[model samples]
Every structure is written in C-alpha cells, then in structure tokens.
Target: MTSVSSPLQRLADALRKDTVGGFLLISAAVLALVLANSPAAGAYNAVREFVIGPSAPLHLDLSIGTWAADGLLAVFFFIVGAELKQEFVHGELRNPRRAVLPIVAAIGGMVVPALLFVAFNLAHPDKIGGWGIPMATDIAFALAVLAIVGRGLPPALRTFLLTLAIVDDLGAITVIAVFYTDDLSFLYLIGAVVLLAVFGYLQQGRGLAGALDRSALPNWVVYVPLAVVIWAFMHESGVHATIAGVAMGMLMRSSTRDGEHESPLHHAEHMLRPWAMGLALPIFALFSAGVSFSGFGTMLTDTVSLGIIVGLILGKLIGILGSAWLTTKLTAAELNPSLAWSDITGMSLLAGIGFTVSLLISELAYPAGTVLEHAKGGVLLASFTASVLASGILLRRSAHYRKKGVPAETAGRE
Candidate 1:
C-alpha cells in the first residue's frame, strides 16, 4: 500500500529536514566545552555569572545562565506545547489505541530512570533532588540522530520516538511545577491565569469571533505583552517560568475556521519554530553546557554522576524495551513487521540522549557547586555515549536493508 500524507508524516519529514538546527546545537555545545577548558575560561565564567535585568521594582535580576534556562528556553517550550497539542488533536495521539505503545514506552522511559537515579542516591539525601535529571529525552537531539542513521527504518519508528519524547516532556514539566518549585504565591498565579484567559479569548476568536481573523491580531501588539506578563507572574509565583509557555499554548484553539485550514496554534508554531530550534536552543546549550573539566575525572566515583549516567544509559533502554515487550504480550498488540527488534533497541538508546532538558533539570536539582558540575558532566557523557551506541545499531540496520535491495522510500509507506 502507498503511504498517505498525514500530520505525523509531515512532522517526520520536517524533523528529517532540520539538519541545520541539529548541527548548530552540537557545535554550540562543543564550543562551550572548548571555551570552558581553554585560556578563555575566565571570560566565559564572568559572562555566565554576570547579573542582568531589573533588580528593585521587578526583582528580575538573574545570572546569564538563569536567563538562558528560564527565559530563552520558554520559546522552545512554546513549540513543544504546540506540538503536543497538535499531536493530541490531529496526529497519532488523536486515537488512543494507536497512541498506547508510545504512551507506555514514555512512562517506562521516565519512571525507570528516576528510580535508578534514586537508587544510586539513596544514601545521600542531599542528592535526591537530582532524580529528575535523567528522566527527560531531548527530542531534538534524538531526532537529529534518528534522521541521520535511521533512513532505512520505517517511518513509524520516528513517529513513535516523537510521541514518546513529547509525553516525557509533559511529565518533566509537571515535575518541575510540583516538586522543584519552592514557596507559593497564589495571587500571582491567579493573575497569570487571568492573563492566560484573556490571551485565549483573543486567540480563540471569542469577542472578535467573526469581526476579524485570529491572525489579524498582531502578535507584537497584543500577544507578546500578554505572554510576558504571564511569564513574569509565573516566575514571581514560584512556578517555573517555562510553564507559562505550555499553559498559553494549550489554551489556544487548534480548530480550523473561516476557510483557513490551519489554526492560530499552527500559525504561531510555524512562525516560532525556526528561531526556537536554530537559535534559542543553541544559545541555551552554549550557556549551560560549559561545565569545567576540573572535576571530570572524579565524576566516575561521584554517586550523583554515576546515578545519572546509569539511569540514562541502562534505565531508559530497559524501561522502554521492556514496556513495549510487555505491552505486546499482554494485549493483542504486535511489533510492526517491517521493523526488527534491533530498530526498537536503537530507538531506546536514542531516547537516552537527554541533552537539553536533562541539563536544565541538573541546574535546578543541584546547587551551583561541585555536585552540580558532576551531574552536568554525567549528562553530557551519557548523551554522547548513547549517540554513539545508537548510531552503530541504526547504521547496521540500514546496511542490512540495503543488502536486501530495500529502498529507503519504502519506509514512508508505514
């Protein structure tokens, strides 16, 4: 059967074409490491440590690293929010039955790694907070790797990974909001909610329903200021600021109207995605990935580092594979005939490439000191290790398919 074009297919194609963003992210990370270890280390440290933003009335003064984590990353989260909404509305997740495998795999991927991290840090109560670090799967990095090495694999594999990673992100965002946050300001949170409602009302075409197209509301004129207000309120309310993006994005209506096939959500995502993937994420990686190598050698013996590494490498592999296996056995579900066990294994390892969100969680979980440095190092190391392992497996599978005279285009038929 010939493959029909769908939202998931389009997403897979878009991801495969985003080679530039993937390369930029990796290059920026490498540049950070090189600068951190070279003679320019002092300048790098000063720039990252320098405080910026308002100090008095706004109380917004924050280090460069904090701005990267809390501010720029929100753009990335906005795209993620839109992707999640789209998936639930029009993609694979729209049907619960079709979505079960990835949902089960995502849960397994998150839970097992967290438990493994906790197991390693059980003796050290101080390090318990870092358990969330290993639970995230950086979809950008994973998709980049998949796009490069999995050309011969079925398109279903890419969709599976994308769905799983998006769910994993939802879990990560929930953890940040509930467990990582400290103190509470219900008033500010309520204010944020009100602003969000106003934003939704405008974007959803409520009062101005037939008066004007939703896109007619200039983003700079109405949306940007409202988003900033919500973000500020979220920050002040002791909730993670990135959550504002998620809440606002979900509040947007995803339905088509007024002879327009695309919703405002799709329009916003289309406008913002290039910047989020190409610049915002790379800048965040540049600021956050500059861990000093002074303690690199000692990370091997460090309990927190060991836990993060093992949790990502071993726990993700076991959890995802085992969950998928169990799901197939317990129900009438079966693996796609076009794919082999090796394909799943490679995808599982790729799921362990938790670079972006993992680093962000590391900063939140551990104080800025030796323990934190070790955790960051572990994240970098584990992601690299996973990339290498996954590359080998996927490449081998590609060659196997080639020898059988299977064309790469055939994969899209799924």
Candidate 2:
C-alpha cells in the first residue's frame, strides 16, 4: 500500500533536521576513527587509498579519499551556495542593517584564527601554510550542537549563528579558491566559466512563466549533465572541483515568478539538501576523519597542531564576540533585543567547531606525513573541545529561558 515516494519523502524530512544530520556526521567520523586505530586500520587505509577512475584525457583517476574531498564535498558546497544566494536575495543579507553584525563577526572569526595560526608557526615556516585549517566553522556540526542544547533559546540567537556561519563559509570558499589552487590551467578554467554562464542562462528560464513561454526539459536531464561537465573542467583546471558547485549554485535564479510558491533556487536546494546531508557529508567524514592516533600526544605538541587548537578554540571565541561588540559600539547596529551577551558568548564558542573544511585545508597545506596527521588530529580535538564547552554554556542558557516561562519570540523584550 505504500507509495514509492513516501519513503523518500520521509527520509528527506529526517535529513533536513539539523540534529539528525549532525548525529550522522558524528557517527561516521567516530566510526572512521575507530576503524583507523583498531585492528582494521590496514583495511581502512587500503579502502581510502584505492583509486578507480578513468585516466584518459582528463587524468581523472583519484583515490577514494580524494574523491570524497574533491567530489562529494562539492555536493555539500552546492547546498551552501544555494543557501547563500537565498540569503543575499531574500534573507538576512538583503538588509545591510541586519547583515553588518554577522558579516563583521565572520571576518573577525577568520582573521583572528589565521593570525593565531601564523603566530604559533612563526618559527616553522615550513608549517605556516596550514593556517587556513582553523578558519572554517562546520555549519552542520555547529548547528547540530546548537539544536540539541539550545532548546527554548531565542530564535534571534539561531539566526545570528546561521548568518555568521554562512558568511564564514563564504570566506572559507574564497580562501580555497585563491590560496589552495596550484598549477592553474587557464584553458580549462575558461571552459568552466563558460559552462557556468550557460547554466545561469538556463536557470533564468526555469520559472513557471518561462516554462510557459518555451518547451523546457527536466532539471536532471539538462542541468545534471551540464553541472558534471563544469565540475570536470574545474577539476582539470587545477582549481578545486568544488568551486564549480558554488558557482552554479550562485548562478541559479532566486526570485520566484508569479503563481510560484518557491524560486528555482529554493526548489533545487530542497531537492538536493537531503543528498548533501544524508550521503555526501557522512561519506566524506567517513573517509576524511580516519587519522591514526598512533602519536596523538606528540602530535598535539607539534607547532602546526598547537596553532590549530588555539586558533579554533581561543581565536574564534575572541574574534567573533569581540567584533560583534565593536560593531555595536562603532555603528548604529545593535544586538537583537532577544539576545544577551551570554548568548553571543556561547555562539562564538560554538563557532569553534571547525571540522569539514578544516580537514580539507589540512590535506591541502601538508603532504601525507606526520604533519598532515597532526593537523587533522588538532582539528578533531579542537572541534570536540569547542562542542563540549559550547554545550555547557548553551544548556545553562536554555534552562534559564525555560524556567522563565517566556516565549522565545519575546524572551528579552521589555
């Protein structure tokens, strides 16, 4: 009696929940760590290192680990791109007044972490390239932690965190595109750009009005192949293939036409977010988080590892909270009435849970060796520490709000 769509719809609904997605990611990472450090370590390494792609004209052959990082993460970034576009066009970023706080906070979050990393690595020029590792806040993980611990907290607090994380993601993406690329190929880069333009042109005609104006094909038939081609060209261009996902996501039409309930951007996001959260991210975590703990104690003492720990935990705390305070003082912007400095403190600490992009940057900054392993270990340790500390703070805040018996919508209102 069950319809085929029912199960998928239920699965999609579950994946959309931040808590569910977060649990899946954490479980995958933990499983990976266990396998890497246990008797199955050899099997884990073999699976990750296995390569199986065509090596023809594009040199597409890559290990499983590389595919997870470069390919699967692209799906995750595409969701980020769609969310960013929606924010810029129809959400918080559309209003400069509403945007300044999170925007400034995100910049402070990035700059302070980089500076902290550089300071720690000043004597080790060879390890300084790893500075980017601590500059990212894994949105899924952070949101999950917040959702679990922040029950009854003001909605404004969640908004503040979401906006800040999105801005933070944009900064991370920019860093990857500009700094991490190597051996650039202009010809292939141009081809990727051209494909992006064509993709954008097609999105303009995806609305109801546009569909009535001309015969149109389903998105899977056209957009999917086009996206794959763009991703391929980007991969060959020596830039991270994930950049293609971000570009295509931004190019999608965000404005809805007459009689439409949602824009093309939202529709696509709705359809794809489940895949990103349910499959792409968890698989990426499974492969990426398998760092061996053979010398974790010594690794923690390494300059590169120390920098990441300090940057993620202390740097993000100081950067996000300090910039937000300064923004309130230096400009007409003010913290939302429903939020207290305590809420911001917890959110700022929560920002320290930098996992996904941090791991990617670790791989990019260091070749396979002890340094790479240490860098990843630092990320895992810092993220765990931050999550625990932030949970303590948010849990207390949530209890306070709950005891007050005040609705979240009017928590701090006079």
TM-score of each: 0.83, 0.89
How would you encode candidate 2's per-residue C-alpha lDDT over 257-296 as one tens digit per residue? 7766988788888988889889988898899878777768
Measured with C-alpha atoms, the lDDT of residue 120 in candidate 1 is 95
lDDT tens per residue, model 1, 258-308: 677788888888777777766777888788778777788898999899999
Candidate 1 backbone collisions, by pair: none
Model 2 lDDT on a 0 to 1 scale? 0.86
List the candidate 2 regions with Cα displacement exceeding 4 Å: 1-4, 176-180, 206-213, 259-261
- For candidate 2, give the lDDT of residue 55: 98
- For candidate 1, the clash count comes to 0
